[model samples]
Target: MATFNVRPDIDAAAEKLGSTMGAKREIKRLPEVLWEGETVEMLATGSYGGGTGLVAMTSMRLVFLKHGVMSQTVEDFPYPKISSVQWQGGMLMGTLTVYTSGNRADIKNMPKDQGAALSDKLRALIAQGGQPAAAPAAAPAQDVGSRLATLDQLRATGAVSDAEYQERRARILDSL
Candidate 1:
């Protein structure tokens, strides 16, 4: 079975996965893998909207993994979901404001050293505006019609193989 949440941030001596996550996960560590295709570009640890955790930038999405006392909250916001991204920070700390299609969130109290750079990177990403196709597995579930169209586009563009497309199509249909 595939392991979940085995990020590089966790100590090697400890388990790579966390109990707060999936059933087959290796516990006692922060998750390393956010998604199958997610390639982490930059990561910064700090307070995200009053919660303590890490913010990771990837080639495909902007991911926020927050750790609570007993569980964790993970948010992977693709560029398509974001309408605007603003970085407000000082030499010590700052906030990242994001406006999505239906929601707006403020990821605040990020360290200046890492936050500023991450904010800049996020700005650049948001400016790029949307990936070519549908959302990843880690992304929040989108509407069925759009999702299907996205899957088709992915297959046509050679981004996903026929088998993968079939699997995803089955999953989408099953969800309905």
Candidate 2:
């Protein structure tokens, strides 16, 4: 087993994974391994969503080991090799080397810093566990509405050309 510091933003990765996967996977501190480990047990499984509306799902059974790495085994679903695991602070970061080339929703378009940031934020939130702060006053909901109001004020003072205002207004509304 190998150990590494949890990145500061690993909470985000965990949160994202939890949200997408429908549950928070637990982690346990291993006495013998001296490392972090997720608390989920498993048989072999893999899922992939399509670019269209369909999703692919598959599963298989495997010989179980009482003390094997779930994270490493999961990465082997579409392939047949154990992935590497690293521990950061209170979180575990692991590589899904076999699935890296595809657009899996859980891993797609993920910002590298996001996971560490998420982990740090989650730790803070857990430490300060309490009701959320009361809502601040809501800003206007529509982006165009706010931009148009600002544009109106600017236009009243001839701050923008008619053509410029029209172009900007069109762009903002189109974004909606």
Candidate 3:
């Protein structure tokens, strides 16, 4: 699946929601619109901490309707369909919206299946969105002098066995 960094504000909100619901939930990196409104936007939901377990989103319209809180369809929110999703830093992120509807849409009383489907859809979409960015290269090798110094400190602190020190010293010397 696609990975994403959870925004602090959104993370906190999801955490709070999880606490209130008393379920095993956590903020995910993926995002989705699933609907279309006047403005267009994506929606994301995960197990916060309370009762909101692994819920998914695929269609904002379906999401709202499932929640029993709907006034229009996907063409009501801001964005329409799956626009984009990718990894930023260490998190998956995406954009979504409703089209042709009003200015805003919401979900409060949707069915569990639909709510969950929406979440699953978002996750799946993220996986299909694109390949994630690569991580930075590893740190360069440290100089032998520094490694010896560290080994000395470790020995003084009784942090290494005599055998360990010898083995490490040999390795350090080989690197020189």
Candidate 4:
């Protein structure tokens, strides 16, 4: 068996999340993407597209990570960007879908119990306005400026609409 140097708190949290074989395998890799001080609240194992991965609900966001033999994929949905989460359950498995402004991600074949628990926890978090007890420290002014410049470039390239540029600009400013 492979071992990862996961923090004690994260290991304990994963223990509470579930004990399925998939969950156990995936949870070991979570420390790779988790930010400093980020707390894992829940974890579920499932398939997204053609990849089998784990979705971890943390204090700041939902992270989906897939580790393959030669490549890895990671996707993060910050609480502020998520509009809603939906769960559909059958006897043994379920699907959890997450919606953002213009994107949706469906994680299917999750164990029913894990999916339902994650859905309820996410709903409560959203209901509470997706604010964690302690907000992360503000970014440096240079970082903020860089983000603004990137947003401007996206607008200039027509990658993001004027409305999107404005919204993203305001979010970056608000973080300051």
Candidate 5:
């Protein structure tokens, strides 16, 4: 459960989220992504009125959850995965933008004091170094024939969309 510093204004919520967006959703169990020793630090709710959600942080990971009247979206990023965090606005309300190597999330409508505190925590953790991600295993180099066969199978099995299938097939042919 989160204790909000500012009482949220329901009528100010965005059309997509509805006026009652921030109403609590089930969070009785810890998310599976939490590591054994992780501890929750900051917990906040409501953003510059764009929607209602929770931004929870641990020593190693940042978790975001948007709860809507009918839908909920959740995202998690380890400190090592976050390339940067941006703070916008001041004291009363603002936004925090977090960037990863390949993705970005703009967490807005936060109070200035909380935002600054969260930013400091994020920076400190990042500076100290974060949990290292396991490197992906490299795929063995395959012959052109085998690569083409794999692409064909992917297309047939609907694992690859049509455009991707065509592009891959063309690339494989060009390689040969």
Candidate 6:
């Protein structure tokens, strides 16, 4: 098992869901598939492609996990790769559809409220250019001369168009 940070609200929600035997089992298996710095934003249980699994929305991606007696399956959708999400609610449950470039996944039988909330959050994430709001780490400063030389080389090789070169050159100069 692995350990990663989870949002406070998601943790509380997970605890409530963990009271069920199946949910507890799935929750315990969550850490195994998570990335080192990934944070779980939301979680729900649903059926996809006829397999029942846990659907988790994390800081960087969406994941579906199913553990059988001797086998386990994991499917992940990175934020940038997702095109859109759709939610349809019924009396007691809802369906979530996630679309990517060449594929789509339908997760059904999710709790109505959870499905709706997840859809809204996913939409917000997509609207924000699929990036979570996190402070960027400070990058090591490079010498202005070397930066300009690199930019010039790129322009010479036609890697960057003239307009782009001009814009970048101006930006580099403005930093001085």
Which prediction has the highest lDDT against the true structure?
4
Instruction: Show the lowest summed lDDT stretch of 10 residues, model 3.
Output: 31-40
lDDT (Cα, 0-100) at 74 in candidate 1: 77
Order by TM-score, highest first: 4, 6, 1, 5, 3, 2
Q: What is the C-alpha RMSD of each candidate to the true structure, in Å?
A: 11.6, 19.9, 18.4, 11.0, 14.3, 14.9
What TM-score would each prediction reach against the true structure? 0.55, 0.22, 0.22, 0.69, 0.53, 0.68
- Answer with 4 or 5, whichever has the higher lDDT: 4
Q: Which lDDT tens digits does candidate 2 get at residues 1-176?
A: 21111221222223333232211111111111111111111211112221111011112111111222233112212212212212132233321112213422232222224334432432333344311223233244443464566556545645456987787678657756
Choose 3 or 5, whichever is better by TM-score.
Answer: 5
Q: Could you say which candidate leads in TM-score?
A: 4
Please give the lDDT score for candidate 4. 0.75
The residue-by-residue lDDT of candidate 3 on 1-176, one tens digit each, is 22222432333434433232312212221122121111112233322222222233222322321121222122222114434322212123221222233332233332343344444544454455422123233233533554566567556655556887898789767754
Model 1 clash pairs are: 5-31, 5-32, 6-31, 6-32, 7-31, 7-32, 17-26, 17-27
lDDT of 2 at 141: 48
| Model 6 per-residue lDDT tens digits across residues 115-143 | 89889989999999999878233232434
lDDT of each: 0.58, 0.28, 0.34, 0.75, 0.56, 0.73
- Write down the RMSD of candidate 6 (Cα, Å): 14.9
The stretch of ten residues in a row with the least summed lDDT in candidate 2 is 52-61
User: Model 4 residue 64 lDDT?
Assistant: 88
Query: What residue runs in model 1 are displaced by over 4 Å at the alpha carbon?
Result: 1-33, 132-176
Which pairs of residues collide in model 5? 47-109, 48-109
Error of 2 at 87 (Å): 36
Worst 10 residues of 4 by lDDT: 1-10
lDDT of 5: 0.56
lDDT of 4 by residue, 77-122 (tens): 9998888999999999999999988899999999899899999988
